[model samples]
Target chain A: MEIGAEAIVQNQTPKRAAVTTGADRPGRRPSSGRFRRLNVLVGVLSIPLFIILWELTSRSGIVNMVLFPPPTVVAAAVLEWMRSGQFFWDVAASLYRVTAGFLLGSALGVLLGILTGQFPVVSSLLSPLFQILRPIPPIAFVPIVILWFGLSEAGKLFLVVWGVFFTVWLSTHIGVQKVDRGLIRAALMLGTPRRQMLQEIILLGALPYIVVGLRTAVSISFYTLVAAELAGTFAGVVYRIEIAQQNLQTGQVMGGLAALGLISFIADRLFAALAERTVWWR
Target chain B: MSGYRSTTKLALASSQPSVKTVSEQPAIQVSNLSIVFDTNRGQMIAVDRVSFDVAAGEFVCIVGPSGCGKSTVLNTIAGLEVPFEGEILVEGSPVGHPRPDIGMVFQQPHLFPWKSVRRNIAHGPRMLGKSAKEAGAIADDLIAMIGLKRFADAYPNTLSGGMQQRVAIARALANEPRVLLMDEPFGALDAQTRAVMQDNLLELRDRIKATIVFVTHDIDEAIVLADRVLIMSAGPGRILREIAVNLPRPRSSAILIEPTYLALKRDCLEVIRAEGLRAFNQSDSS
Candidate 1:
């Protein structure tokens, strides 16, 4: 009996090994960590290529160096501005306006968007007004904004708020509207109360869209920020660019434009990073 | 014949107590329930005066054709849909709105993609004002019960379709509801996975003893799981017939091969076949 049991076990071992190998062969699993590292490498490689192209274009004189400065020259300007703390002030001012307006507008937009999405009558009544208003550019509002509120911080801030608000609002509305009906039913059946449904179901369902909207609006914030400071400000990066233009300081003008581009790029990258961390669940 | 007589004796014994107290209510009393949907063509009746009493801890299956309103009845019971006429009473109270006393599992897993398996299971308690710690305990217990303890922290997207639906089942049971409404929960899974799920469901039902109202179009599924099967008509859905399964307790996939189980399955298929053929003929005439 013992010898027979041992023979059976020995036969099964090879059979089990064969079966396991056959199963593994069908679905060839690759390591995900390698794919992620490859993506990061591709992104890092693009930065140097961009700088090399900028230097080549400037050296070739295809476009005036005054109009489009080389990346090295812009790097030098960045260093000079950094040492003098002029870069710090410009960054601080821009960040302050964008952050404040973005927060205020987003909060209101999210609230109203959720309401309109949930309530049919509210959505019907408010959708048309928003649809008409959304198409009107934030920059177009600059003249009227200045006339109404003056060229003070309020005027610029209002434009930024308006810009971020509609984007966030529209995305949020779409998000809530498109939430899976089945999931809602599942939640309801599980005894999720009506008042808590928005936070538990609606907001969570709309999170991915909200993140996308917020990230997109970061670029809009920069747009409104630049336009806001261009006409009225005695300070700000745009104002400094205007000063350089008036003085006919080609390098400084290019430098200021480069600074704006650099700041916009950094802001976009920051938003992307924040979105990745916050919306891992999404 | 002996089994039938025994079932009749059991029914009589149960009803004898009710004779003294006819006014006493069932755990779930669905009476004259009808649901109508307004379409471009006209008013369509989905459920037509479907009345049934689900005694506490009874395992019932609502079986019918694909278009039959078995799911609609479950929805009405769950308080997700308001019946056009009649009413549903749960524990002597009319079900006017959704409450946690009833839990539901859908055909699709419907687990939140973002939450881990554990978090999805815990969502019910979290919503019910339980502390995170308390909810976590319930979640852990349920995850273990579903044999998914290893995958508790894994996201729903990372799991297979069967695993996702298993998580959904665990999530529903996490609240420890009195009545569990399952709308073709195994319908989305492959044949092998579905067999495993059916066995798991029977085991869970035996252990938990929660009143289950399962909806399915598969006759074999109806035979294997249900203590009683309610067959429904299509379109304006209504309970056409009720058949007691009367199979032995503690059923598993092997029960399918039993002679009595096969006979009952054939009986169910004949009824569904008649309804299906009738529907086809009517549609053809139109």
Candidate 2:
């Protein structure tokens, strides 16, 4: 009886395999493979195709060449800016402002977030005030910041810091509050002291959210950097963009915009890589 | 077996002296333990004056249907539940806060996702101010006991459910608590894995010798693992009956097929079915 059952099973196996392979091969597999290859080809051509179209549009006089510079003209302008040594100084100044403001803002935000998230009294005292101020755009503070600091570096720092602070603070606050109560209870049962509870359990538990907040603050820092430099700056990429716009050096303006985009893109990618490392478990 | 005992001894040396003095007292005492929760409707009684004692080194299982507050009672003993009207003493002291002497394994394992198996097991010792080296040594011993030495450096997410729960059990044991409370630790696993884990736990229990109060709804599981099974009724939960298991030790889930085990299970199910029918009829009439 067992040998007969085994013989029947062996006979049935090839038929099922043949049926599946026959179905998969003729219609499904090759078409899907071809479609996937087409997708890859299209993705690879995407940016170059856009650049060629942009170049043709500018040269064809569909738009003013001066205002809508060709990619070649933008590239030339970027090269010229680099050759003049101003590009290095502009990048340095912008980097300094963003890094300093981001560090100070995120530090304060995390400290206050832990305080407000952990203690109801602290939340009651500061949360209402923070909620009121958080909705107002940091760019709106440009005028007030200029009046307070009068074109000094401090005014620029203040604007960027303001922009970065709220996002980090809100996310951190929510993250801390959302930490698994089970984890806290488990930690408590294991005899974790109050201080160690915060440092080891609460902080680490909320870290993924905190990292997300900091990444968002990275972009917010860039956005505020634009507003700050446009308000007033001695040397920065946005300042150079403004100068180029006034002079009708449209190519240079476009180049500066491209430079800013590239820098922000790099910053975001860097932050994303750092975020993966920050929340290593995920 | 000898290596396991000595390692446990060295790890528990600090607390060993206190154990002898309190040997006569029950490891856990819950007297008139009533817990009420304020739901949206009104004050709902989760546990209604339920009381029990687990003697030193005894294995007790609280079996009940869902919402019967078996877990709440276990949590109360672990000091994770509060604002209850009653008294609880662990190792002869009134339980209010979670003491290091009482370790709990929650249903979901609740292993720290960020830490490796070894590090997760090491956490309790580290929290109690043992040096890093001491904690690592303690964790390694548990890692071997649980038979997860190969996965010691693995993160919680990488392990299978049974393995993760094993690590959680090991982590709870790291502190060498006098009382170990488990709240349906195997409830979430598949049937095959759950049976294996039950057998593994029975084996581990012999060596650990900690007073264990396990809460579960599985009758077969309770009969397989416990020295005494407390059957609880739902809706303003209270203990319906207590059945003592006279099953021999060095037992496995294989004994689940034994005539004696089936008899004990039948007694539990009868009490549960009677209460369940009464509850259903009363609700239907209302």
Candidate 3:
């Protein structure tokens, strides 16, 4: 023990001397600092500069003004949307569909995933059926959903849930299967019963992969929402966009696109925050 | 193989009284144990007709090179693996699936990431039908025993490798198993941590009553901790020789520098060297 402490003390002396002398070569320091500040300045200007360029081009008539609306025109359309009551319904309807579909799909996916991943017999029964259906895009089912439910909320929810289910299921299945063998052996020796193994070891071991699956499904849920609303809906962001396009309300179309992008972005950010807390140990 | 160093010469003077009553019964007995695996290439023999008995409260170390099947033997005793040719008895019953009375510490700590140090140690007790309060008390005592009281609430990722292994050991002991099997528990640690863990294990072993069977590839570790060292040869692994280490107790890493310890190490190494040469010649001739 004394020898180990002496060795560490000896290692510290040279490190302390190096830290006291700031720059080993002074010539390269200032240029590197300037480049880093320049990079940040350019990054801050990128979006505003693009907006200004679009305004100039639209006003200058470089392209047809009817088709190429600028940011200012889009903002005005958004303000008009807020003045009416429909925007609230549009946002609420879309948020509700995304939230409801995500929860239902994720619950079913995770439960079945755990069953199939942990049990060979369950995998043999369900994995093939899921595998066959998983490759079919949820958007491709819009026609069938319309025929089955005729633009009801159930049809919309079904599409969004379909988009989410497969991604979550496959990831959870792989995660459960890939859980370290050493962990199971250790748990077995510690007297963990087969029934309790799921709660005790498997779920927590596979949590990181499950969180990743859910994060991906968040974006996928939004995509299926667009398909569902576009197929047919009374009041939704994507439905509004479709209505404005038919009337050639180009500014409103652009505004709806921005709103959809913003909401999906925020949902993704929120899920990312939740994911960090879920796997807190990492 | 040296009769002059018969275990009785040192077992008589040892301060550890358990050494005197070693004949109480075999805590673990393996008679003609063999393990064979079927691979794509054909069948392979892992352990071939090997047998040994671990006396109650005895600390036996199985030393060998990699793939010597020493760990396979230990795993079979713990009921993690099965032997095809021979039967194993732990206390008087035939071996099967993992029983609550036999504990194992693997090479990796394998601490549950979601669990705090205390919860990890308490898991075994809770599974055995202990109440929450009773389990918490057991976990607290072990947290103090392993000297990790401050880390009781900390999760596994926050711990150092040595600290995690200490918790794993504590967790195995929480069940108070009659037999403790360790498969190179300190093999993954660095040299300094390995030495420190070895010393700590020595101290911890004296306080616990579980009969220990530790498997390691390192000869020094085997000599430092074992009452009897079982040297094994690789490729259809078999016990090559048994060296009864009559070394005194209250021993530590300091024994590595002692003249007597050096002589004992020499004897174990010579046996291993001869076994290696025999295997090499056989493989070449075949």
User: Which prediction has the highest TM-score against the true structure?
Assistant: 3
| Candidate 3 residue pairs that clash | none
TM-score of candidate 2 versus the correct structure, residues matched by position:
0.92
Model 2 chain A scores worst on lDDT over the 10 consecutive residues at A1-10
DockQ comparison, 2 vs 3, better candidate:
3
- Once fitted onto the true fold, the runs of candidate 1 whose alpha carbons sit more than 4 angstroms away are A1-85, B1-25
Model 2 spans with C-alpha error above 4 angstroms: A1-25, B1-23
TM-score of each: 0.84, 0.92, 0.93
Candidate 3: count the clashes: 0
Give lDDT tens digits, candidate 2, residues A1-282.
Answer: 223445888999999999989986776877899999999999999999999999999999889999899999999999999999999999999999999999999998999999999999999999999999999999999999999999999999999889988889998999999999999998999999877888888999889889999999999999999999999879999999999999999999999999999999999999999899989987
Poorly placed runs, candidate 3 (over 4 Å):
A1-25, B1-16
Rank the candidate models, highest DockQ first: 3, 2, 1
Q: A44-118 in candidate 1: lDDT tens per residue? A: 989898889879999897998876778777677667877998877876887788889888888878888888888
Give the Å shift of residue B286 in candidate 2: 3.1
Tens-digit per-residue lDDT, B1-286, candidate 1 = 0123234444444444321233345678988998889989998888888899988777889988777888888888888887468988987788867789888999998988778998898899988889999999999877877777779899888888888888999999988898899999999877777888898887667556467889998878888888789999898798878999888866788888999988888888788788889888999999
